[model samples]
Every structure is written in C-alpha cells, then in structure tokens.
Target: MAANALLKTQSPTFASPNSALDNIVLEYSISYFLIDLLHYLIFFPTDILFILHHLATLYVFLTCRYIIHHGAFAFFMLLILAEVTSLCQNIWTLAGFRRADLPAAAKLYEFLSPPFYALYTLVRGILGPLLVYKMVVFYLSGVAENLIPRWAWVSWMFVIITAILVSIVWVFDHWVDWFKGRNYKAAKKVV
Candidate 1:
C-alpha cells in the first residue's frame, strides 16, 4: 500500500475517492484493529493504552473507509511509516518477554535491540512526524472540506498526533534505559 502510494504518478489526495484497492486495504486494517481491540478487551482488560490505541486506529480507518470514503492515501502512507518497524519491534518484544528464562532469547533480544531501537526511532520520531506535518498542512488548508469534512480531519489529526507523541515517549524511555546501562557498565569497568 505504501509502495502504491509512493509510486503512483497521479497521487491520491485526502479528497480523492477510494479506489478498489483502497477499500480492500481499509477493510483489512479495520478488521485487524477490531479483532485486536476485542482481544485486549477480553484478555488484557486493564491494558487501557493498547485498547485506546486500537480504538483510535479503528476510528481513523472506519471514518476513512465508511464515513468520508476518502483519505485512504493519507492513511496508507501513514500506515507505512507507522508499521515499518513493527515486525522487528514485535520480535524484540517477544524475545524480551522470554529473555529471563532463556539464554537464546536474551541473546536475540540483545542483538536486535539496538538496531530495532534505531530504526523505530528514525521512523516514528523523525519520518512519521514529517509525513504527518505534510498531511496536516494539506488538511488544514480546507481544500478537501467538500470531500473530507473538517471535523473528520481534525479528529484524525488529534488521534495521529497523540499516537506519535506516545511513540516518541516510548522510544525515549528505551533510549534512556540503554544509555543508563551503558554508563553503568563503563563505571563498573573503571571501578
């Protein structure tokens, strides 16, 4: 989807009508988020953050797919930025969960951590914000008000901005931990 968005000569805009491909992508994304939201609600009921994230994501996809029938291009591009590091991050997280019990998992976690963190930081902290800024600029210009309503774009921006902020904070916390561990190791060596 991201490749499609990037490679298309005639780029779809926030106001462009949904293509057949866009509908497929939007439906798949909506289903994934809905199922994940249900899982969190049932098993991790107290996991408010994940639940809210899923809900917010569903809102964006649902609105884009059903309500506005536009903005798939924007959503697809953002999806690319948001999910580029998901596989690596997921592997790292799974390894982390088992690291204490298994030496191999620990090794894998250690090996993957730095690269994953770097990629994630670059994508979420830098690229994501850049793309979002462009999206915001376009949306706020009121060019697409007829196709995509003001309220929809404004709410989407709110959700996107909040998600990005949370991602930045999450990655920053990891970076702090990594630096502290490195410093501690260096001090221990000196001692």
Candidate 2:
C-alpha cells in the first residue's frame, strides 16, 4: 500500500488503473463479506447492524469492481486502510471462540484483546473517515471526478453513512465498558 501511495504521486494521471492486487482484494472482500452476512442471519440474528454493514460492504465492492472502476487507485488505498485491522480482528474473533480454560489459549486471547481493540479503533474508526474524505474530497476534486459516476458516489455516501451509524452503535454496546475502565472478565460465551 505504501508503494501504491508512491505510485499515486508518480502516475502521470495522479491515480493509476486498478491493479491485479486490487481485484484480488476486492474478490476476497466480496466473498468474505457475503459469507459473514449469511452467517449473521443464523448465528448472530441480533447483530442486525453488522448484517447491514456486510451488505453495504458487498454493495460497494461489487459496484467498484465491475460497474465503476475509476479512481481505483485512491479507492484501493482506502481498502488497504480497511485491511490494517484484519489480522487483529481475525485473531481476536478466532481466539475468543477457543476454550480459555486451556492456559495457552487463555493467554493468547488475553494478549490479543487490547491490541485488537486499539487497532480496530484506529483503523476502522479513524482511517475509515480518512477514506471517505479522500474519496469525496481528493478523488472527486481531482481529474478522476468523472471516473466515478454521480449515482455511484451517492451509493457510496449511503454505505459510508450506514457504516458510521453502525460503528457508533457497536462502540456503545460493546466497547464503552472497556473505555470506562471496567474490569475484564473472559466472555463465558463467544460470538
């Protein structure tokens, strides 16, 4: 991604066409996001916000990958920002489901929670907005403005708004106690 940033500056047009890596990432995102949305229908029936989020994710990915492929370099940079927390979220979620009665698993889970939450906040909460700004302000302000159509921009705006609302709800419901310095206890059940 850093290399992509360099390329962005070097490109004669300031943003390059979508690369193979971008396509690969988009495909993976579409697959995983749809799978997650489906899983939420059964396992996390109450997590309606996340389900909606996943739907928005697929909408954005599919739209960008096929329908509107302009401003892709900038968009790819934003996608990389989104991926910064992938390892942390995956490890936290996967390890959270393990039997913490096992000493090793317990320690691993314990070790991951703080970093996971911190990284999640930084990448998703902070960087997500940066992505919106770049897409709307930088990308649109530049010559690539015509690359992304008005309807696509409108659709992306809706997705981003939904994402922000979901993030607010998620933080309040799940992370507020942590931020308030409440004592930690291993979750008896993991989702």
TM-scores for all predictions: 0.92, 0.70
Give stretches of model 1 more than 4 Å off. Answer: 1-11
- Model 2 residue 61 CA deviation (Å) reads 1.1
lDDT for each candidate structure: 0.87, 0.66
What's the residue-level lDDT of 72 in candidate 2?
A: 53
Q: Candidate 1 — worst ten consecutive residues by lDDT sum?
A: 2-11
What are the per-residue Cα lDDT tens digits for candidate 2 across 6-118? 36443523235555666666677688888888899989989876777788878887887787764455555656766677777777767777836566766787677777777
Expressed as tens digits, the lDDT of each residue in 46-102 for candidate 1 is: 989889999999999999888888888888888988789999998998999899999
lDDT of 2: 0.66
In model 2, state the lDDT of residue 160.
Answer: 74
Residue 80 in candidate 2, Cα distance off native in Å: 1.9
Candidate 1 achieves a global lDDT of 0.87
Candidate 2: stretches off by over 4 Å = 1-21, 98-108, 139-142, 179-191
Question: What number of clashing residue pairs does each candidate have, in the order they appear?
Answer: 0, 0
Q: Give the TM-score of candidate 2.
A: 0.70
